[model samples]
Target: MTATTIPTKTIYAGTGRRKASIARVRLIPGSGKLTINGLPGESYLQYSPNYIRITYGPLHTLGLDKEYDILVNAQGGGLTGQADAIRLGVARALCNVNPEHRGALKAEGHLTRDSRVKERRKYGLRKARKAPQFSKR
Candidate 1:
């Protein structure tokens, strides 16, 4: 009988939300690589510099952009919201990797989750805040 051993390394996880989007992130020690929902980060993000930049904000601020691989499973909202959520998740995972990172990530504002979301449309209104043209008749 032969026994096989699997190498174990520390894995950090975090979850973030923005608008209707949610991102579950995992940080693994390796060359910088990003995979989202089984797709390459760049391809999934449509190679947008803005989005790519946003997702790497925390890592860049901490000078660890090339020190870890990011794997994210994101769902719901649009790409913008998903991008923001990923940023927050990455920041949080970094914190889990090292509590001391909280201070720096917080200072960079990457640890903050954007809480703004579309307001639910009211039953009596055409939209969340808009009502049918004022009938001043």
Candidate 2:
């Protein structure tokens, strides 16, 4: 008699960054569940609908929101930046699962990493470009 073995589902990985935030994302074949830094996505994001929407934008765009589970580890920056970073990470992971998703994700701008960050303060500036109070005696 011959033995048959079943293949396990594959896991896809991707990294994304926005401002000072970084996210490591994983996509696996499962229900539409999301976890961030060992916590449920909603709880971690403070139950904000906008954060949830931003984090799931890529999957929604490709109509795969309920097809796979997402696992994310994010750090640094604020909530918004972390959400955007997770979005890009998810988009990249989708592309990894199927290269054909690239065009769709790209068209939706999910594949683009936001590069905007806070400007550094100069020596003579109060903050970034803000000047100190002028004293004209």
Question: Over the stretch 42-132, how does candidate 1's per-residue lDDT look in tens digits?
Answer: 9999999999999999999999989999999999999999999999999988988889999999988998888899989999899999988
What C-alpha lDDT do the candidate models reach, one value each?
0.91, 0.91
| lDDT for 11 (candidate 1) | 76
lDDT of 2 by residue, 2-93 (tens): 11223786778888999999999988888999999999999999999999999999999989989989999999999999999999999988
The lDDT of model 2 is: 0.91
The best candidate by TM-score is 2
Backbone clashes in each candidate structure, one number apiece?
0, 0
- Give the local distance difference test score of model 1: 0.91
Report residue 29 deviation for candidate 2 (angstroms).
0.7
Which residue ranges in model 2 land beyond 4 Å of their true spot? 1-7
